[model samples]
Target chain A: MKYLPLIWAGIWRKRSRAILMLLQIASAFVLFGVLQGLDTGVSQTIAKQHGDRLYVSSSVAMGDPLPIGLLARIQSVPGIEYVTPRADFDGSYQKLDQFVPVVAGDVDSFFKVYEELKTSPAAIRALRNDRSGAIVGILTMRKYGWRIGDHIVLTSGLPTSNGSHDWGFDIVGTYDTPDQPTSATALITNFTYLNESRLTGRDHADMFVTKIDSAADADRIGLAIDNAFANSSNETHTQSEAELAAAQLQQLGDLDFIVHGIIGAVFFAVLFATGALMMQSLRERVPELAVLKTVGFTDRRVMALILAESVTFCLVAAGIGLALSTLLLPLARQQIGFSRVPDIVFAEGAACAVVLAFVSGWIPASRGSRLQVVDALAGR
Target chain B: MSFLDQTFALTATALRSMSGRRGAALVTVIGVTTVVGVLISLLALSNGARALGGSEASPDEAVVLGSGAASSQQSVLTRDEALAVRNAPGIKRAPDGTLYLSATTMVSVDAIRSNGKRGSVALVGFTPAIRLFAPGVKLIAGRMYRPGVHELIVSDPLRKMYRGLELGDHITLRGTEWTVVGIAAGNGTVNDSILRADADTVMSAFGRNTYQQVIVELTSPAAFDTFKSWALSNPALPVQVKTEAADFDDTFGQLHRLLDFVAYFIGGVMASGAICGALNSLYASVDARRRELATLRAIGFGGGPIIASVLIEGMLLALPGAFLGAAAAWLLFNGHVLSTEGLIFTLTVTPGLLVVSVSWALAMGLIGASLPALRAARVPVAVALRAT
Candidate 1:
């Protein structure tokens, strides 16, 4: 710790070169921080699975709706706690670019099945009483700046019975899940109103969400539910909520592969640049290091000083880079209209910075430590 | 020394000095290589995706979609509306003397991928005239599906991605079993992502009473505007007409834009880091060569030759880095196939992409060399000599 001043002086000796290297390291970590944040956001969205819940949909295709009558049959299955049916309506708000996913279902049953949605009893009653009442997720509410009792209209891409594609709903409440920020982007409405008002495709539910009494019964119940509809017109496929979310996220893109590819490229270049600079700086200071060794500084202390200098360069640059990304993440999320991006993963990033510091500093520091005082003094 | 003699001497001196500082030169080369390699690979991905979207339609074809429809899947046209479009002028006739028009229906069906993930696949239903419209399409295995039968033809790429898509395999759609009779391959078009069946049969199976869109072969490319105006003039029918190429642009424009933005944004960010690294290495080299450069100046060498030598050295180092990076990208990503949302594309490492990558590296090298070269030129001879 007492060698801090010595290491600090070593770094600042070449101000321009040190500053440029600092900028290089900072930029690399900035990319790392932002990409890691996005990667975590996507992974977390798929990873937020309630173990006891399962999603049941048509085996034919995602767009195929199961009969509404199947709700009672699914409810009768043993080990089922609650079941709800949801119908998806893909639409945009006022413009083509503002695509908002809307899901309609029985409000009471939906609340029962998805207990993670935190809503008051008054909001639930309003949704049940008003046929056109809808509940908007917190993110959507904040994004559109909507308040209670606001009537929002969506233009359905699909035609409706009234010969127009306009669907209006009253926003009666806001919903949020404690851990899953992605869920807060969905808009939920009353299925009865959608089924009655829509010009076509009535008496059908897009999928069924069933909460089982025990996690152990998930596989058995999934198979049993599929068996009940086997040989029937509407055969079903049931998957645990985790599996369903994972599959859906996978369809978006192989984000993990792309993120890791970019991160690998950035770090590989950073390591080479930083390591080369460290070696060059150490080579220039060999005579100084020899003088220190001759003046009662041990070889290990010389090595420690060099290592500390390099690690200080890396960690300080990483700190600034991570701080910059943290400040910019919210703006990025706002521009992208995705609320799921969390703050930078500090633990993973800090650990990475530390490892990079060691790797970049190791060879140069060892060489400094192995320097012979007589030879280095004689300018060999 | 004469100008030629000075130029040769400076060039020889720069080469000798670079050889002495091989470590720093190597670092600069590797840094540039990383930036160019990453940039080229990402741009290749964007290019591949754009090609898939753009190659689906030709200029000689036109399509009539329901009013205000953004995509075929969202468009709905009743039989009467489609019949009205069929009667529109400027439509070419096939050898059978029938108008070469195909009413198509697009639907998304749930399917299990080979990796056991459940995802949606696009099922496109088109009239038999589709073979005429897309002449480049070919049946690679088995025969085409017969109309009115519960038969389907899967694209080769789709078959590779999904299960139960092999020849003779049965896929259940809307509770009806359909046999996969053939594997079709399109010429890098969006058709490669779809399953094909008879339009009428698909409508009845899915209980859809409307066609999504009508595609017509125009008599000539110039006839597209005439056909479009004719289709839109029928006030009784609510329809919009566009060239087939325009429809593809509408459908996939946003996706292409996003991919391009991502490619450029990431490439720019990475290139900045590489440039900074290059600048640092070059600055250090100039500092190390202060005395030598000052001595050269005192011996009557012009500043132009000194600056030219540094710039030339920078380009010489950067060009090979660019080549190495481009070669690496080609080795790693050429013909690499990836799928997203059921659309599959292969990364293409074209000569055009290689040129773009090399240009990016050269730009970095030039910018990195400028400031250091200026500082080296401006170093007063007496001050540089008197120091150290």
Candidate 2:
């Protein structure tokens, strides 16, 4: 085609500009990649906890713990198979920077209720036999460099002073979760180890995790549990596990809006900048455009050439940005931890980049093609 | 040959040339403006957040978390413990001999956002000393709430984030509805997001009979060692004493860091697109000006002046964009309330932010124009003259 030389010459003439365009595209892709990665991480965390389970706690909020005595009352209710009570022990290792999750639960009931935690038989037996035994998530163990038999002393941030200052516990086993956010950060200890110990208060349990016999009656079962404790001193709030997690995220407040706004603003900046550049480039080639027009080139051909160039530039930049983003994501994860950034990501937003480029390119390309051949020739 | 004459000549040439290539110049300005606008807006947010997150409390003011409590809200102290803390040494006395002590508790609430979206909001119960510690809290809408009444005074940010937060609107806290009687403004601090109510009302509603943390204004900052030693050594009551500013940092440091990372990360990505736009436009400008540049060179318009002219043209385009972006940001976000967890803050676009944004536009222009300017200057006069 006659346009092939024009394309080659156009690109060859502005080598630096072309190279910069590619770099920019690559960088944008990287940014898009990271944002998608973070979104994926959040979604994954939420997805990990989704199951046929329901949570029962104080109606006020998730932080408000329900009484331990409500477990048996729930077990007796119809469509409820088993009830496992877990106490939230808010303590940390040495410093506040290091997270130490001490979840107190009856080992047998917890194991029966949730089969996600995979541990050794001997370790489970040892945990059951010992009074102050604990099973740490595999990721937690790896983070702290703790062995199976290591005796860890966790300092309490929650008030509890019964001659046991720094609570000592023997690590019995390292367990893994089904989908891996289980070890994102948290250490699970036995309920008896906490309940029998003087650490727990009279009426405090982080919440109760219950398994219903019928999946269909989850909402009904939640309502029934709430109804049971409706008039009590501490009213109960019950919802499916998904709802509970969603409610907790809702507590994060306007994060989605903030994120959406930021994304919109960033995209606006990208479009404005890129559109301006493409428009200027098309306009500057007025003489070349006029020559093409005089040689029987249609306005459509002129538009296509400019649009193609714009798309080529954006696609090059996007590809480079994405390549860099993928390479750097692993390093970022290692530095920040999996809790902050996940391993997997989605590239669905690339569609957004393509659309942005097309629209931006079209605007200037149209303006350039619409220029009169006579006026364009006069510029020379 | 005079410096001013040369500068004037340069300006004339730059303006005339830019006018000739008005279409290209406009594009360059648009691109640079966007880059500058976004960069400046983020900086403003970062500045606003930092200013608010910092402890405006007096240097002598100290807070006490429970023996094991890492967070200020998680610490629980009993009535007896509060009394003991009041009697402790190093507590500054008022003219009336009252100890400058305030006990507070914080609870995060699930709230509805302005867009009818659900969000987290924190509620705080504070004694009268909360006013003493934070003087920036000014009642803008209604009167300061009565001490014993179950009335609440919300910050402006909260008022913006949550719907139905106007005066006389009832908001439920700890399962009990409290009437909003006033709207207060904190100096853009973290407290701007809280719903402030009577201490007893919060305590009773949450069944937290025990106080979360005891804050006491010390006699002097120098007495911190003595005060800390005495408070920690107290066998009767175990508590940890830390500066108000340090405590604020501890509470929201990770959050601020996370936000900063997000801003920079997004900005960096967007900047890449902007940079590409700049390069393309500048390269085209240089190519189109070959004849004009050759004439200028023939007339002793040195390569330096020509390059400077091009850079000035780029900056001219970019600086306007910075202001435009700032104007847009101000119109969109200024005075707008946004919530996170239980805290709220208004998105502020200050004058300083505008300056930063404009400067960033200038930077984008300069960077974008440099390569093209260099290439234009490097063009052989004879070759350029024959370009047409």
Candidate 3:
């Protein structure tokens, strides 16, 4: 209790040093928070996908289209409850850089598949009645300044497009999902309209979505379905929601390693800078530390106090950094668009920053503690 | 002794004394190493991509894109178009006047996991004559297919990523059974992730009648002028011809530039914070050694040597840090190959990256040490000595 003044005086004596260290820690915390939030949000979005839902793609590859005739065969698969077959018409939004996922699904089946969608019955009816009507995510609606019943056209960079951008659809209803904010990056239209108008030939559905009674039977059901088509014209590969999400992420290549390397490099640089600052600060205070020792303070006690001071400084800085991070995320999301940034949450990662901040301080604190009082007094 | 000489001696003495402070020296090294290492890794990523994309093509070669195909994936030509291209004027031909032309298709395939993991693999179907268009591609094992056989060649990277795919291993692709009869290497192009096969086999399997792109070789640089004018004169001919190097650059340039921008943008922002930390520490070091500097000044040491000494010490500390950082980055990312969208590329670490990293560290040290050196040099003798 008596050492409160000493701790306060220590900070006051090197206010600039303390402030600089705090700022350093705060910036690191902010970065960690935002990055972690993004990763977490992307995962959570995928994980939150309706557990009952399943996606069936070509056993051969994702890019290959499944025969439209296979939709009924998939629907006839044993233990299958409901099925929604979607045809992927790959296109871009108004901007060339932005990839807009255009999916053609049965209206009733899609509504049934996404049980969490909370929309007026009239809107759902409106979507179902018009063949060319489209349904986009809530975030997507905000992004493109589109309203219900607005007409939107999408262009394909692929050679299949006619003069200008090939296809257009009317906006019917805006939807939201806790699964992934970026799911709004896609626009869902009627499969019937797509098949009748733009699409040609036997290749109809890109993939089929199936829902079952229990997730425990997911593997068993997936195997049975794949086995059903093993020797047939169009082979199938059925994956769980998680596996599909993982496969999509895998397209980005070794994300776990890449993200880790990036974060590790960034943090390593931050730690180095902090350690140097702390060492220099401690060296300057050697005489002061000696004076404290002479005044009957034990080395261990002095070390603990310094460590505690550092931990406190780091924690405070991290808190400010986290606060700043939360503020920055919405703006970043807005600027980068929902497809890239999504709804990123930073709470859990800020906790990690707090721990890192203390660890960074401890290295220098331990060195400061090991100083010989006599040498320190003699200005060595 | 002259005042300047004395100052230089004092400055050297001070540096030697400071060098003995192992703890402080270690801290400086640690700081500098991290800054340098990170900067180098980013440089490697950018330059490695550039080298891969840039050094892969030949100068005399030309890439012919079909009228509708803006990208390699979109470009497809009929047999007549390919033959027309081959017979075009000034096309570099063998002594028999046979042109160096290869028609190829580029398609992306999903690699099925024998172990339940999925990966992307690029599928390139080319004629046996593809060797002429891509001279850098080399077969490591087995032999090229006998023209019409269902034999396929796998890239070295493809062999590593997938299972049961070796020389003579059979794999079904696009409902057609293909025997992996050979292994090939691209000249650091995206083809490293591809499954190379006969062009006819690939086209028939994928249900495409036309070729994706055609590569043609011209005899001389000046021939391109006549070729272009003649080609433009026939407006109905839906083929755009450009140097093979230019087409490859255009194909991957946007992506490479995007990655470079990201690496630099993120790195630059992070470096600013690190620099701030360096400056603060140096300022503290100079302030603490006030009496030490003042005493040297009182003994007839001048300011210039003092500044130089402090700067040198900071740089010395930084150089070790830079090396440490570079070594660590190399240990982590060097030769590491991973796939994205099915294209495999090794995280190329080169000697040039290390030099860049160390140079960056040295620069940071010089900048960081300047103000502190100035403070140490300008310290008032009486005031510094009078403190405690």
Candidate 4:
């Protein structure tokens, strides 16, 4: 504790050199914090507690169109709480580049199954009363500047019985999810309207989702639902909600490996730079270290001071980098689907900083300690 | 000596001194390597996507899709509507009165990946006219699938990415078994990601009542405008017409743009760190040679020569890392097959990507050298000489 000022002064002996190394180490941590934060957030999204929720899609492929009749059969299965048929009705707004993701289902059962989606009962009733009424999400509303009671026309690839590709709806209400804001981008409508009005793909749904009262029975109940139509032409692939999300995220091409690859290369390079700079700075301090030795500073004590200097420098740099990352994280919220940097990433950054400091500073510190006072004083 | 001569002599002298400062020089080299390697790896990915999107796109070919459809998956065209497109004017006609057109439909099928995870791949069915529309597609193994039978010919990449896709294997979808008859290689287009089969058979088996889109080869590139007006003339055919290139753009341009954005953003952050590292090393090196440079200045050498020499040394040190980094990325990732968003593609490290790597590395080297170069030119000769 008494040598604190001495170590601090050693780190800043040459202001320009120290500052350059500081910037170098800090920039590496910036990449580390951002990448690891985003990576951890993605894993958290996959690791969200969806144990009680179960998804049933076609065994052949997702979006393979299961019959609506299967929805009732699955609902009748034992231990099921609520079930809703989900169908995607993505459309293009005024411009072809603008895509509006609309989900069609029995709004009453759908909202009950997906309790995270917040909306008023009036909107549900309106969607039921008017087949063309749609409940748009708040994010979608803000994006297109839409107001309730506004009539909007969206063009879809699916054709109506009249051979028209246009689907018009009256915006009845707005909805949002606080926990996961990205889910708030969906536009919800009643399933009956889309199924009955579509020209060819009628009486079918993309998938079915059901919730169980207790998470303990989730796997057994999911299997029972799949068993109901195991050998039928429309076989189902049942999975827990979390498993489904993980599979979807995996479809983005082994994200963990990519993130780790880039991070690994960055660290490898940073490690070499830190080591070289430590050695260079230590070489310049031989005479001062010899003077300390002549004044009866133990060899071990000299080594500790060198190590302390590195620890202080690297940790301070990492702290600055992580602080900046937390501030800039929100800008990437939409892309990475994470609003905040996870706490574990900050902890991991600090651990990395310590390890880097120790490894890079070890040889230089030992060399400084092992120097002969007489030889070092002679400028050897 | 002239200014240029002085610059050359000083640079040579600095190069001679670089051996003593090998550690600092090594740090700069390694810093540049990481920045360039990562940048090129990502650029290579985006470049591969761009290559796939634009490769083999003929200006004379036109794609017709339902007006509201964003991609082929969302498009739907009834049989009569598709026939109307092929019957329109400006379509190339053979001597036997056949039109150069192919109506296609797609169905997503579940498959197990090599890693034993559930994945999906596209099975697309094209009419007999497909041979004319895509003349470059060829069977790499086995034979072409026979029409009116449940047979599929998988693309090379598709077969490599998923299991149970080998030739002679049977795949069951919806209680129907389809035999894999051949392995095909495409001309770096969307078809490379999909398996091909008979259009009518796929539609009937998948319970699809409509063709997703119709692709036609025009008599000339100029014929696209004529075909567009003709297809939109009747309200019965509510379809959109675009040159094949534009259609490819609509299908994949956004994804490529996204890849490029990610590459540049990550590369920029890493380059900033690499610049800091190079700067620190150059500073150390300049300090090491402070006495030597001061004595030269005291004698007669101008600051201009010293500055120019330092900058050259920095770039020269960085030059090898640019090649090594690009070479490393190429060796590790080039021609690697991967999939994202249900679209399979190969990572191709092109010559153009090498150019990107060198430019970024050299830029980092130059920016890192600037401040150090300036400080070296301004060293106080009298003070430095009298010290120590």
Residue A164, candidate 4: alpha-carbon lDDT = 93
- Write candidate 3's Cα lDDT for B1-388 as tens digits: 7656765676567666765455545555665666566656666665556655556567777777765334555455666666677657877766764567778876666766445577767677776566656455688888776557777788876787788678989877656777888888644557676788788877777665667677767777778777766665775465767787778776777656866775665555455556556667677667767888898789777788888877876777678777888897788777666566666666777887777777777877887788788988999999889989
Better of 2 and 3 by lDDT: 2
Reference-based TM-score, model 1: 0.93
Q: Chain A TM-score per model, please list them.
A: 0.90, 0.85, 0.81, 0.96
Worst 10 residues of 3 chain A by lDDT: A157-166
Q: Which candidate is the best by DockQ?
A: 4
lDDT for every model? 0.82, 0.71, 0.69, 0.87
Q: Report the poorest 10 consecutive residues by lDDT, candidate 1 chain A.
A: A334-343
What is every candidate's C-alpha DockQ against the true complex, given to 2 decimals? Answer: 0.53, 0.47, 0.32, 0.77
Kept native contacts, as fractions per model, are: 0.56, 0.56, 0.36, 0.77
Ranking by DockQ: 4, 1, 2, 3
Candidate 1, residues A75-107, lDDT tens digits: the string is: 899999888889886667877557778888788
For model 2, residues A1-380, the per-residue Cα lDDT tens digits are 66666765765455676676566656656766666665566656576564568888776666576667777888888888777888876677877657677777777777666776777777778889988888888787888899988999887756554523367889888788755553545676777667666443554677888888766788888888899887676677787876766666765655556555656655665676566656656756789888989998899988888766666556656666666766766655643334333443333555666687789888877877787988889983
- Per-residue C-alpha lDDT of model 4 across residues A190-223, encoded as one tens digit per residue: 8988888888889999999888888899889888
Predicted structure with the largest TM-score when compared to the true one? 4
What DockQ class does candidate 3 belong to? acceptable
Regions of model 2 farther than 4 Å from truth = A1-13, A44-48, A163-165, A181-184, A196-200, A269-313, A328-347, A360-380, B2-4, B78-80, B108-120, B127-153, B156-187, B233-237
Each prediction's TM-score versus the true structure = 0.93, 0.87, 0.84, 0.97
lDDT of 4 by residue, B1-388 (tens): 8899989999999999889989989998998998889888888888778876656588899999987898866898888889888669899987788899999998898899988988888889999878766454689999988889999999888888889999999998998899999999855567788888999999989888889999999999998888899998988889988888888887888778988987898888888988988888888778888999999999899999999988888898888899999999999999877787678877789888888888888888888889999999999999999988
Of candidates 2 and 1, the better by lDDT: 1
Which sequence of candidate numbers ranks them by lDDT, best first? 4, 1, 2, 3
lDDT of 2 by residue, B223-325 (tens): 7778888888878676778988787777776666766775666666666567666767777778877787788778777777777877876777677888887
Model 4: interface root-mean-square deviation in Å: 1.2
